[model samples]
Target: MDPGQGKKAVLNRSCRTNTSFLSFLCVYTIMKWALLSVWDKTGIVDLAQALIQHNFSIMSSGGTGTALAGAGIPFTEVSRYTGFPEMMDGRVKTLHPKVHGGLLGRRQIDDAIMAKYGINRIGLLVVNLYPFERMSRESLPLEKLIEYIDVGGPAMIRAAAKNFKDVAVVVDPSDYPEVVKTLSSNVGFSHEQRLIFAKKAFARTAAYDAAISNHLSNLDNTFPPILTLQFTNGRMLRYGENPHQQAAVYGTTGIAGAEPLQGKQMSYNNYLDVNAGTALLAEFEEPTAVIVKHNNPCGVSVGTDILEAYLSARDVDPVSAYGSVVSLNREVDKKLAEAIDSTFVEVVAAPSFTRDAVEAMRKKENMRVLILPERNTSDEVRTIDGGVLVQRTPAYQENWQVITDRDPTTDEMSALRIAWKVCKHTKSNTIIFADQKRTLGIGAGQMSRVDSAKIAIEKACAPLAGSAVASDAFLPFPDTLEVAAKAGATALVQPGGSIRDDEVIKAANRLNVAMVFTGVRYFRH
Candidate 1:
């Protein structure tokens, strides 16, 4: 048999044997040809076997061909079929015109041209890009990383996806079962199924390119020339901030991906409060508890045990703690679960919950209980009217310079650290008063700094005397210091960069208040 004639000779012979072109066209459409080139070999052998059973010829190359041969599943080597050798260490294997022409060829329209070029029609394309993302995380050199960029893979994927009307592209291994099922049912992929697969294939290639772009951009600049953001696995939410607005959550990690074990559907407000609470809770290493309401921390405390921390944190502002999101650094046990069940909390996030604790919390069936894993900090993004804003704080440490005549005592310094951590996460124009282990008062999101100080004093659950105060920003005037001193705050911490710093320091000395400067400002607006 002449390899050059191949399937084209069969069609030509049928036409010469008094057979109509329409009959030959029917035979060509039913004779499926699948091209399989993948980095992930999972389920590839099984899929190839199924394709062969369905009377579909398979073409593969490199490791895919090796695996298929090892599994005793007969397949045509891509290089053999293309009449081109796999040169450049297999990099130049699938970039030939035959591969693209097969994937992108139109039925009946390009049949003559395809036959002339010996390009077989590819009905199915199964491809996955190289492990660029996984290798990017590894300690590989630039030259090695470039090899994983996957040039031919993405090109072939785009071609097949663009010709979805004639080709079915599969990039995800999870969809292999569906393809097998469809073939077994003797019904080829429907238009809708092909379109869906094509959309997913394009998205996979786009995300792959985005990863490469973002990584290279980091080496040259802080951000890329053109930012491309992609998130997958979108879960539709019941509603947005209100019932009238539509919303959906995307991404598969961190708070955006968390799903409740057993509870009512999470709302937009619930996700916001939980995100804020978990972020603040991450700052503590001890058994700490953080309670958030309306995107603000109502109470925060560190104790010897999680139960004590939860109790003290809740007591800091019991009124605001109602129906709030609670986050803890430690695991949730039965005792803590029972204690949480005593209140009307909306969500509880922790590393883990014991079996007994889950049973105890069953009393409140509507409460959302989820595991909050450690989350790495990424760029902060916010949307405005015209576009969006992106900001990131480089790694830093607090200066913690004592600027007043009197330095903070040991207990005051400990309280100052706690207050500073809470203040960093709280809203701007905020004042946080804390004792050694727990916050005594919190004033956040006020218009004026002096008003914030006054509100903190007014909201104190415990005596403000012998407590430390932390302001999110520098004190522009001595009036806030005077107000805090008059309220019995013995020590204060603020970012000292205001023009009136000298006057504020003098007032601190005059009022016998200890003040420290932390050259970093934490303004959360």
Candidate 2:
């Protein structure tokens, strides 16, 4: 071939390749058609109305179709287009070619195949899934729970998502209005908006299927097989556990179970301290009062009367107890009100309060006194990355018994029980010293177990001599037992765990003090 002819030929080939690539790019950029289906109808009517105004053909299945029809909107049935009925009690709807072909097709490239098969183009897909979490929580029958598992919804969503360059997908109800507004303002959603929506749709579908995957997959060692996570909208609090840091209250999915009555808005730290205070309250069968600060119990006491208990709990750390969050298992009476009059309290949460008692507490206008409406115990939560950790709250010890050489005299055992119960609510390594109806001293948030015991003895003042002591965990060394005994600790309760547990018992024996192993540790941290 001649050199000049070769050059011309090369230029022609380059132009043809450029034109082909440009055509592909243009076709990929242009999208047509839309599919709409949803289980939650909260804002579906408005979304459908907007789509109809925009001249986008709507296709829906089963209840979603019924919902659109009831709202006086017209939509194409997936069954009619696919030539298949929604078999098996409506579970088989939308799992068909007409629905998927529209969602997955590239309008320009797939026209030949679509034309031959008579399939429609789908440019947008908007879908929301059934509430399996809500269903399971309601104690739905096994069959009903299984039925709520969404099939067609996810398939269409995934198809549209995969073809995002030519398709837009919206999975959350919250995104409906925004997507509608953007699409309404322009001929189509911008590439930026489509990209954002596509990412969100995939995430929603992933989380949804993860829930299902965890559900059906059998567990060999994993007790739950599937871990369920439910989060209620978090409320911005006045502050975190501290006023300096910003905080928010992320409520549990068990929202109907929350019961806080008549209190100032809880801060970040307020809720933590209050939960500790309340969990301590659950431990006592009798009327009890517990005051806590920085996740540690400053004072706690069970008494025949509320005022006495409050006074005793307050006495444990009068200085640290200032502005403490307080909780009571029973109603707060006038006497308890009088005891708290001298100090600043962040909150006083109780099941109930007398009219006069409420009036008395109101004297301190700045004080937050809340009444929790729920009388029963429930789970407490701790959040971690990507998932949450939960546990059934340790309830009142109904079966607590003395299991040691020094059997607690009925009276001493009662006091020890109250002290140990409250100790768990304190941040660990924890120690509490009390006698009869009031906390004499408290030591909380220590690094070493023995140090906590020493702090409790120092705080107890003279009361340390005869007061009973509660150790959140066992005396790892016999020295802690010796220290408590020297400080005048008489009766003791602890969850024993040291290898030389017998040595600690021997130390208690030598001191002539009674010791009981609770077999439960109350570690708040």
Quick one: best lDDT, which candidate? Answer: 1
Worst 10 residues of 2 by lDDT: 1-10
lDDT of each: 0.91, 0.74
Off by over 4 Å in 1: 1-12, 16-22, 25-30
Candidate 1: tens digits of C-alpha lDDT, residues 8-90: 55566665575457455536543568999999999999999999899888889999989998999877888888888999998
Worst 10 residues of 1 by lDDT: 1-10
Each prediction's RMSD over C-alphas, in Å, is 2.1, 10.1
TM-score of each predicted structure versus truth: 0.96, 0.70
Error of 1 at 441 (Å): 0.8
Q: What is the alpha-carbon lDDT of model 2 when measured against the actual structure?
A: 0.74
